[model samples]
Target: MIKSMTGYGCGARDNHKVKYTVEIKSLNSKFLELTLRLPKAFSDKELTLRSECTRLIERGKVNITVTVEYVDQTAAAATINTELLKNYFRQLEAVANELGTNRGNLFELALNMPEVISHNEEEADEEEAALLLNAFQEAVAQLNEFRKDEGVVLKQDLSTRTQDILRLLTEVEAVETDRIPLIRDRISQYMDETVGKENVDMNRFEQELIFYIDKLDITEEKVRLRSHCNYFLQALDAADANGKKLGFISQEMGREINTLGSKANHAGIQQIVIRMKEELEKIKEQLLNVL
Candidate 1:
């Protein structure tokens, strides 16, 4: 089945100490391009996260944002250096005495001094990392589901367009019979005008006309175009990533359509070819987002 390259998903997990939230967004791209936004403590695991994303997402421009919010009061509590605070207060009091000023708000001044309150940098914890990984997996699952849903709609649109092209091809076939006779009549008229009808060698002219009409025959193009369209539908039903393969098939189909257009000497057949080309272009545009 086909899958689209654009989607969005979010997953969150909360524990006693921390809450982990993971959000991922994807857009169509020819290759896998990933951007990560995570806490400094988890910076070392960026490569692992990228590898996981690559394994899950075949091709797209992906962005991941991880948020770690501390829920426990103790997790973010700052430690006070009581001895340093006491020393600063004593010094400030002495200074105040020398200046003959009251030591108002001395404790507050001491508490604001450098080194009095400090927060220890948090380290990477294996258990917390595991929790984050779980959230990431959930987010990926949601994204895949989103892609699948979009793929269903895309599949329907593509199928309809392909069938439309096939219908137009049939119309081309309906008017094909007139082309040969028209060409022969035009050639005969030209010969009669250039050289008198009596001087024209009828047998040789007939043989040459047969050869010329054969050259302009679009029999092979119509057959190959039908085959290409069938192959495109088959690829859509396959259970693998066939975006590139579908693109190649569309190119082949375009070739046949172009050849048919060029060889179609009748105005009606040319109009049908134009419609087929329009439908084929729509298919190509949609294929860019398929995987």
Candidate 2:
């Protein structure tokens, strides 16, 4: 049950005190990269929110935006001490310049400083915070559902491409059965033309022929390729597609297929190997979106 790394979800909750809206969007990425933007009032809970997002999303480039609409605009207006903020910013900028640290986030840093935002000496509104948390949870749940749906589509595409490669593998096997005989006959005919057939030692010729044919043999490659494909298909059906695991399996498949191609003296088998490689490339592309 793999999930896709791409999705969008939004959740909203409103009450007499305030309203909260949370929107989350995710895209494919090799690791978890989260960018969260919320009102400064919830700064204390930022770490908790981030931890929860990481737990749920697992991995992706995720962007979360939270919007808060208070019923009392006048009350919200008086929340920030502007003069204090300006003073804090000036000091922070001077300190940053003196320390040779970054000054890009001076305003944001000053805004989050203690006493910069005051609610008339009262504690934070627990009820409003709970509402926002609930909205965020809803958004994450919706996002998970979206990912699951997309995962189904990815799963189907991967399965089809893998089966196509397996089918092409069988085609390679069919052509491979005639390879040894063809190589033996071609070499014998060449010897007959270059040196009279009577001059060739039949026993030594047979021994050398066996050794040459053994070098071109693709039996082990075919077996390993088939095994890798079967393992890939099995992994696809697991609880999580585990992209890294599938990627490793695909790499193994590629090694075997490449060996098959290099050793394949027959043009028909080579063409089939080309098809398998194409199918495998498609599989790898789809795996990029898998979770």
Candidate 3:
């Protein structure tokens, strides 16, 4: 079955120490393009996360955002520089003595100094990583489900459009029968009027008419176009990433339809060919989002 490249998914987990939220958004792209946002502590695991996303999403412009909120205040434990604080206080006291100014809030000012309070870098925890991975997997699963649902709609539209083109092809066949005879009669009447019926060479005229009709015959194009349409449907039914393949088939279908249009001298057949082209164009537009 075909899958659409556009989708959105989110998964979140909240616990005592931390809260993990994963959001994934995707849009149609020719290749798998990924943009990942991760916490600094999890920066080392970015490659693993990217690889996992690439494995699941073959083609799309994918954006993944991971939010890690620390619920426990102690998660980011801060240490005070006692020595620095005391040194600042002593310096401030000396300045106060020299200038005879009150050292009001001196302790608070010292505590607010740069580097006086610093957080210790926490080591990566395997358990927390596993939990985050679980959330990430859930988000991916949800995205796949979204893609599948969108794929069903695309499949239906594409299939219906293909059938419409086939119906137009049948209409072309209906009008095609009278086209050659009309051409022959028109040419014969013109020759009889200009060159006189007795002077015309019937044998030579028959040979030339046969050659002309053969050049304009759309039998091969119609057969090939039908085959291409069937192949497109088959690929859509099979389990694989056939977006590019479908595009190639659509191009082939376009070629046949154009050929039919050019060869169809009859006005009714050309109109039917135009309708076929319109349906094929719709299929191409929808294929852009298919994977």
TM-score of each: 0.86, 0.83, 0.86
The lDDT per prediction is: 0.89, 0.89, 0.88
Q: Is candidate 1 or candidate 3 better by lDDT?
A: 1
After superposition, the stretches of candidate 1 with alpha carbons farther than 4 Å from their true spots are 78-122
> Which tens-of-lDDT digit does each residue in 61-163 have in candidate 3?
9999998777887876879999999998888888888999878878888888887887633344777788789899999999999999999999999999998
State the local distance difference test value for candidate 3. Answer: 0.88
Cand. 3 TM to true fold: 0.86
Best by lDDT: 1
Candidate 2 Cα deviation (angstroms), residue 158: 0.5
Q: Give all candidate RMSDs, comma-separated.
A: 4.6, 7.4, 3.7
For model 1, what is the alpha-carbon lDDT of residue 269? Answer: 91
Sorted on TM-score, highest at the top, how do the candidates line up? Answer: 3, 1, 2
Error of 1 at 286 (Å): 0.7
166-198, model 2: which lDDT tens digit per residue? 889888877777788889999999999999899
Worst 10 residues of 3 by lDDT: 118-127
